[model samples]
Structure formats: C-alpha cells, structure tokens
Target: MATVNPPRGMRDFLPAEKARRERVLAVIRARYRAHGFDEIETPVMEEYSRLHAGIGGDNEKLAFNVLARGLDADAIRAAADDPAALTDLGLRYDLTVPLARFYASHRGELPGVFRAIQIAPVWRAERPQKGRYRQFVQCDIDIIGDATARAESELIAATLDTLDALGLEGGVVRVNDRRVLDWMLSSFGFAEDERPRVLITIDKLDKIGADGVVRELADRGAATEAVEAFGAFLRRPSSADVPFGEQQIRGALPDGVPDEIVAHLTGIGDAVAAARPGESGIPVVFDPFLVRGMGYYTGTIFELAHPSVGYSLGGGGRYDGMIGRFLGQDVPAVGFSIGFERIVDLLEGEADAVDRAIVLVHDRDVTVAELVAVKADLVAGGARVRLEQRPKNLKPLLERAVADGYTGFAFVAAGSAPADIEVKPLA
Candidate 1:
C-alpha cells in the first residue's frame, strides 16, 4: 500500500485543529447571519475556462488542474504520454467564479440583490511554505445586483467585527478603488493596454519597496523619466496638500465618465469611517498603491493584512462585470473573501490556548437509543460529545483522546441511557 499521508501543500487537520477552526468559523458565520446574508454552496470542481476566465494575474497561474479522477491505473499511466488532453476540470480557483455561475442560473429565484456567505476549500498549486499553502479554505460573503455603497461599507465593518471576534488582532483592512487606480495610472501617463502590466508591477510595491518597483519599470522598458514619474506618483501621500490641480487624474477617466467616480470614492472613504469610528479596530485607508493583482476587479479593491504576516488574510473587491461574462447581463456586485487557512495559521496559538474539551463513552452492545440519549443530554447541557469508536480499549482511547485534545470524558455502560453515564473530568 502507498504511504498514507496528505499530498504536499495540503493538511490533515487533527481533531484539535478542526475544533479550533470550527470555533472561528462559527464566529464568522454568526456575523454573516446577523447581517442577513444567506448561505450557499458551490462545487469543489468547475470547468477550467469558467473558473479561470475572469481570474486575472497570478491566480490563474496557480489554479490546480484536476484533469482526470477515478480514471483507473491504466488511464492514469496513459496520461503521462499526453498531458494537454488532461485539463478538463480544475479545483475551483476561487469562490467568486462559482458564485457568478450560481447567480446567473438562479437570478430569477433570488431577490433583486442577493447576499450570500460561502465557506469552502480552494486549491492553488503554489510552492507551499509556512504561511503559503496549496490548499486552503475561503470564507466569502458577497452581495450582487445592488449598486449601493452602503452595502459595501457595512460589509467592511462586518468583516472587521468578524475578524475581531475570531481573535486575529491588529489587521488593517486596506481599501482602494480600482477606478481610483485607473484614475491614478492615467494620471501617471499609462495607456489602457499598459495598465494591467503596470498595475501588476505596482502591486509588488509592498513586497518589494519603491526602489525595487522603479527598477522593475526600468526593466519593463519604461523610459527613465516615466519610471521615476510613476514612482513619484505612487509615493504621493493622499494627505499631501497638492490639490487635484492638474488634469492628470481627470484625463484618465474615459470620455463621459462622470466626475462622480472621484466623488463616489470620497463618499466611500467617509462611509468606511462612519461605519467604524475611532480606535482603529480595523483601520481602512485610501492607498493609491493598492492595485490588486486580479484583472477582474472593476471598482473598489481591498485587502486585509497583519504587520507580521506580510500577506493578506484575504481580500476582494467589486467585480461589477463578472456575472455579465456568463449571464450576458451586467449585474453589479461587491464581495470579500476571508482566507480561513491563513487565519488558522496566524491563529494557531489561540487553539492551543483553548482548554475546553469533551470525550465519549466506549462500549460494545450499547443500545443505539442509549448512546443517542446520552449524546443528546450532554449536548443539551452545553458539553461537546465525542463518541468513541467500537473495539477500542479504554487506556489507549483515553490517551489518544487527551492527546487529540479532550479535557472531559463521560462513560456510559452498554445498554444504558445517558442518565446512567458517569461523567468524569479528564485532566
């Protein structure tokens, strides 16, 4: 038999880790529920084109292609000869594509503006490291068909509260409008075709400092003056007293784009502040430098990050036109995705610190009704119950359960009701 271990970059979460994740997920789910969002599930696999079409930049590169499955050993061996014929399906790149498909198919049944919360695993075939993983879970909440800024603002506020609830402290939710990035780039003298490549380079500013970015522009063949100007442009603090004097930003706006694009951004800034005043619980800022790598985002783009982690816990933005690619009708939308795996990594200590636990009874010939009753009673009394597998010995079971993270135990004899259980507190 082959060695039994999860594939590289994936994980086999032990019981303790699973419980901790569940607790974090519960807190997030509670906030989503409070905000009146419904829950929807999307498949783990989707066709390659549908999943990757609107997914821009590095994400498309990282998608894990699941070309064949259950294809017996013979077929698998044949795939080694011809790989191109293998990319029929892929692990979903992200939740947004699946959500877009779902919305397109069920728009009629859903309310005019649909709000949903989705929690699922997403796969990426990246080189795995301490914080970067090939497989991870995304907890996303998105609202579609409604073009209201208030909805977006509230979602940001709710996301902050949810993060706080989960105990991943000190994260800053950086906000910027893609439209604003468009404005800024045009201000810096970039044409429409150059925008994607330029923004891709600019997105690296945080990882690679200003000098590095300037060097990248030079390498890309941007003129020295243009590169220097672009650097100077990105570095200009939003607080700088330089008024919106020149047509730099304004000229970038497409012909007939109302002045309201700039105005709407200003309004969004105010709404963000008003939604959560003071204390910097999760500070939101207008970063001219926040050019998210994805090409699909058409409006506001945001990311949440911690000072130490240096990568996003998760980030998302308004991809107002994504649904139109499939449905053929534009349905404006905004969303945010929480990186559950990153959150778990950043919060591994929290789970270690938690002391609560439960253990199950071990016995053969126990009546199903008795076992069920016992489980129900403990649950009703606010205790978690973990039923022991059959044919397991008490000593090894107790040791395993404790090592696996259980702080309490209850033993019920075979054919007995839960009322007859001898609840023992395990140390």
Candidate 2:
C-alpha cells in the first residue's frame, strides 16, 4: 500500500494552511512590488552543467540532478563510473543562480538596471527537520547591473519594509563585506591561495569558538603566523556590540580595515534609515566575522536575524561576478531572500483586509442554484463567499469555518434569498 503522506521534506497544505500561506505571500509580493521590483520567473530546473558550474558553492553538491532519458543498461553501466555523465539537468537549490542565467538570456529586453522579484520553490537534498524543508519556497528580491551601494541600500530598505508589513518588527540585519574579510585575512598574514580554505574555517567561529577555529586551522596545516595572528584577533576583547552604528562598525574590525568598506556598510544604514525613518525598529549589526558560506559573494553580505529564532530568518550578499559568468561581462548584483517557510510559521494568523470572507451553510434540500445565488449576492457585496453542505452536526462545520478564516456563516434553505438568510458571526 502506498503511504498516505507527502514525501519527506515536502508538505500537503490543507485549505486553511494554504490560505494562510497565500495571505502571507500576498503581503510579501505587494510590498516588493511597491518597492519597484517586478516579479519574474525562470524554469525550476537548469542544465546540470549550469547548476554545477562552480558558482552555486556548496549548494551544487545538494542539487537533485535528473538522469538523461533513454539510456540503455550498457550506457548506464558505462556512466556509472561518473554519475554526472548520466544527468543533463538539475533542480535549482537557490534563486540567485537562475536569476543570473535569466538576466544573461534576456539582457537586451531588460532595463539598464533590473529590479526583480522571484517567489518560487527551490529544491535541495537536505535532511528535513523543524524549519527546514528540501522542497520549499524562497522569496527573493534582487537588483542587477548596478555597481554602486545604491543597490544594496534599496534591497535592505525594501526587506525591512516587507518585514514591517508582515508585522515582523524588530528584525535585525547583520552586515559584512567580502572585501573586508579578504583584507583582514591579508593583514593577519594568510597567503592569497589559502584565504578561501582559511575563510571556510573562520566561518566555523560561531560553532567552534576562537580556540576551536585556531586548533582546526593549525591541524589543517595552515600558516603558523596567520593562525596565531587571527587567533589573537578573535580572542581579543569583543568590540562589536549591537545597535548597529558607524562607530560600532569601525570598532568591530582591526585598525587597518579599509575606509571604502566601512563607508559602504555605513552608507547602506544611512539609506535604509532615510527611507524607513526613526519609527522603524530593526537593528543593523556589523559583524567582521560574518563569512557567508556562499563562495561567490564578492563585496557585501548580510543576514536577517530575529531575537526569537536561533537560526537566521534569511540572508544574501553581493555576487557581482555571477551575471558575468552567463553574459561574458561583469554585472553588479545584490539580493536579499526571505526564508518563506520560516517566516510563514512565525506569522500570527490575522484577518487580511483583502478578504471579507463568509460561508453559506446550505442543507441537502437546497438546490445548487439557490446556494450559488446566495453566494453570488454576498460575493458581489465584496465578501468572499463559500458554499458548504450543512451536516447533521452543525457545530463542527461552523468551527471549521472560523478556522478557515470565514468571519461569518449563514443557514440557507431550499429557496432562501440573500436577504432572508441571517448571517451570524463565526467568531
């Protein structure tokens, strides 16, 4: 017998769950649209070559590759030594890579600078757990072809606005720059070739602590001086206290951290502050050690963190080199993604003004025509109407109506007119 459930790491949303998800997505879509981002979509799968093109970082390994069709057993056996030979396509693990491909394909049709909104499902081969899903939606807003800090600033502003619109106030954004990390590494005596591997270890600072990072780097046969220097820096007094400010950004890093990187981080804060103003409650933190796992991040990187969650709500960074891989020329790009599944779980169910919903509970004796007729009248009056057959037990049906976000329910008879039905508050 087939298992009566969705695949692991996937879900089946009931009517109420689907509605709640859609309601939350509506808020996100509208907010992104208001900020001048035009929604776009690409195919869910891309060529396996593109998906594994070294740009997707660790996610490429997690890609669900599709095997080439019509392969004979001989051919399959031939390719068994190299699994990639049997595959031609793979599901995207994130939106940025697809967006890069899309921009390259349609560069001529797009504006000089493109603001895009992509709210779509992405797949990864992850072990499912609470707040993590292999098949989950990602809500992304990106700006491509703009080299200045303006792109990052606009993205941050829009993100904060969308969070506020979703009633998720007090969300914090931790900011960093890839360039700062590179500079800091050089200052600490790490050689050019080893910086990538060194950064990988540095990213573990949170989980392993300073001593663990130093020990791991030393064991990995990293430069003795570089490890000791960085270890000293990490263990030094903690200067990056929050309430993100220009001074705090400076204090977080070593003395030689470049001025341009500092200015870029501060500029984003100033821009967001101007657009959102004093009333906005989100704090932007500057973390020198924020090494986002994505290797393609070129300049700035930021992650959205909330006090209530142990993990990041969402994050992204500048990957200026990404579009160039597809288009054969560099194009500045920055994006911020909202972890849709995580945010949806955190949102408290509330009434959406867009839906003034009601239910028409009709008996078996009532004609479909009559039921629909009453529903039509209510719908025309700007109410979202649903017609349900009245069960012998009315209490359960009425309770479900409330749970499904119907504000009121009315009893309808065989030929009851809209005016004749008395609507009672389901709440």
Candidate 3:
C-alpha cells in the first residue's frame, strides 16, 4: 500500500482540536452579531479573473488555480503554452476580494450600508511557518456604503472588543492613511506615477531597516535626493510625537493636499480612545510608516498587533474602490479581519477543557437499543455524549478516556435500562 499523508502545509484538526476552534469561533460570531453585522459566506473558489483582478496586491500571485477539466489531449496540447487560458477558476486568497464580488452581485438585496461579518477559510500558497498555514480562517467585519470616518471607528472598536472577549487583550492598533503616503511622496518631489513603486519599497521598511530601504530605492533608480530625503523623513520620531510630526509633515508638503486628511487620521485616534477608554485600554498609535502592502486600501489603514505574537493579530482598512471594479460605481467600505489561526495559536495554552461524557458498555451483550437510549438521555440532559463498546479490561478504557479530556463517564451493563446507567466523575 502507498503511504498516505496530508499535504505539506495543511493540518488535520482532530475532534478535540476542532471543538476548541469551534468554541473560539462561536465567541467571535456572537460578538460580530452584537455589533449589528450580519454573517455572510462566499465560495472557497472564485473565477480566475476575479481572483486576479488587481485588488489583492502580491497575494494575487499566490492563488491556487484550478485547471479546466474534461479537455481532450489535443485541446490541452493546443493551449499548453498559455497556462492562464487553461485555468478557469482559483481558490480565494482572501475574503475581501470575494466580498467585493458578492456585494456587486447582490447589491440590490443588501442594505445601502451593509455591515457584513464573514468567518471562513482562505487559501494562500505561501511558505508555511509557525502559525501560518495554506488554509486558515479569517474573521472579517466590513461596513459598506458608509463614507464617514465613523465606519472605520466602529470597525476598530468592534474588532478590539471581539479580541477582548477572546481573552486576548492589550493589542496595539497602528493607524495610518494611504493619502498620507501620497502626500509624503508628493512632498519628496515624487511624481504620481512613481508613488506606487516607492510605496511598495517603503512597505518593506519593517523587514529591511531604514538604510536598506534607501539602498533598495537607489538601486531601483529613484532620484538620489528624493531617496535620501524620504529615508530621513521615515526615521523621524512621529508615532511618539503625533502633533509635532503632523506639523513637520504639513510644513514639508505643498499647498495641494487638504488638511481634512490630518483631521481624519486624528479622528480615528480619538474614536479609538473613546471606544477603549481606561487604564487597561488597548493603545492606538499613529504610525507614519505603517503602509499596508495591499494596493486597494484608499484611506485609513490599521493593523492590530499583540505583544505576545510576532505577527499581526489582524488588520484591515478602507477599500472604497474595490467594489467599483465590479459595480461600475464607487461604494465606500472599511473592514478588519482577525487572524483566526494566530489568535487560536496564542490561546492554545489557555484553551478551556471540552466538557463531555463518554458511555462505555462493559458487557458485550448490551443491546444496541439500550446504548441508544443511554446516549439520547445523556444528550437531552445537555451533555456531549460519546458511546464506546467497553473491552474486557476496563482500566485501559478508563485511562484512554481520561487522556481524551472526558469530564465524566457512564458505565452501561448488559440489559441495563436508561435509568440504570451509572454516571461518575472522571476526576
């Protein structure tokens, strides 16, 4: 027989692990509902064209494409040179793209400002590491048709509240506006066309230090003076000194940029403070260099990072133009997606024990009807019941039950009535 194993980057969540994950997901779902966000689910796979529609940034390249099936050998040979033509569908890399497609198709049925909650698995063909996987769930909440800054504020507050409910507290939210980057680039004398490439390079500032960004930009043929000035500007102490930093940036920019951009950024800060006001409140920092790599984020962009985790717990921003690609009209939207897998990994040590009962039939002569009755009684009494045929040696079975985290056990003998089932605590 050939050896059988799961694919390299995927995992098999056994019963206990799956239960724990479902419990976490339950808490998140309830919290999202409380915030007036209705649940929505899209297909795991989307058309290749929609998946690669330029909204996903570099993540689009990681989509797992599905090749056309039932084609003859001659037909396959004719299209062998063009792989894009052969692949008609692909697994969704993220929720936002599919949501955009969903809203476009069902706009009439949805409210003008739809607040949607999507908790589903997304696939990406990236190299897996410690908390990263090929398939993982993303808990996302998005508000569409609301152009006001309140949408961003509500999404941030709701997300933080959900995190707190999950027992994961003290996360820091780093806020930045994409327009701020555009203004900065303009201030540095970078042309509109050059801003995208420069933003992509600047997005790597976290991975590659200040000097590395300058070197990369210089290598990419950016103006020497602009590169040096931008590098110096990025190194400034802005996050710690928002007011002074804002004044300096405003001074550097030409007259074209509006003051409303700064106001919007400040509003998000104030709203975040208002939403989480207290000594134990999560901190919201205004970071100038916090450019989310996604090209779809038009205005406010924020990322939630926990001190315990090396990566972001979740992040989202306003993507007003995404739906426009399909609808042919702009719909203002803002979203935040909690990194479900990372949150689960962080909470693994503190996961609550699954409360369940196992019924072991010690007597082999126990009738199937008797066992079913016992199981039904246990279940009706609000117990998670598992039925197992007991072996000659009860010690091994008891030991296995204890290791499986069963809270209690019921031993059913041959011809025992449902009322005769003896239940005992495992402890």
Q: What is the C-alpha lDDT of each candidate?
A: 0.75, 0.88, 0.83
Off by over 4 Å in 1: 54-56, 66-86, 234-259, 277-282, 351-380, 386-399, 410-424
Q: Given candidate 1, what's the lDDT at residue 63?
A: 81
Which candidate achieves the best lDDT against the true structure? 2
Estimate the overall C-alpha local distance difference test score of candidate 1.
0.75
Task: Assess candidate 2 and give its lDDT.
Answer: 0.88
Estimate, for each residue in 1-427, the C-alpha lDDT of model 2 and write its tens digit: 9999998999998887888889899999999999999999899999999999999999998899999999999999999977589999999999999999999999999999999999999999998998778999999999998888899988888888898898887888889999999999999999999999999998888899999999999998899998999998888887534566678877887787778778888888877778866754436778888999998999999999888777888999999999999878899999999999888888755424336788888889998888878888998899988888888898998888777778888889997987897878776
| Order by lDDT, highest first | 2, 3, 1
- Candidate 2 ranges beyond 4 A from true positions: 240-246, 280-282, 348-354
Candidate 3 lDDT at 291 equals 85
lDDT of 3 by residue, 1-427 (tens): 7647677678888766887899899999999899899999899999998988888999998899999888788888899997678889999999999999999999999998999999999899989887778888889999999998889888988888888899987877887889888887888877788788888888888899898999999999888888878887766664334332345345444445578997776677667778776744336766667888898999999999888867788899999999999999999999999989888888985776666666454567788898888888888887877777777777787777666667778778877777887788876
* Residue 186 alpha-carbon offset, candidate 3, angstroms: 1.5
Predicted structure 1, TM vs. truth: 0.81
In candidate 3 the C-alpha lDDT for residue 227 amounts to 88
Task: List the RMSD of every prediction in angstroms.
Answer: 5.3, 1.9, 2.9
TM-score on alpha carbons, each prediction: 0.81, 0.95, 0.90
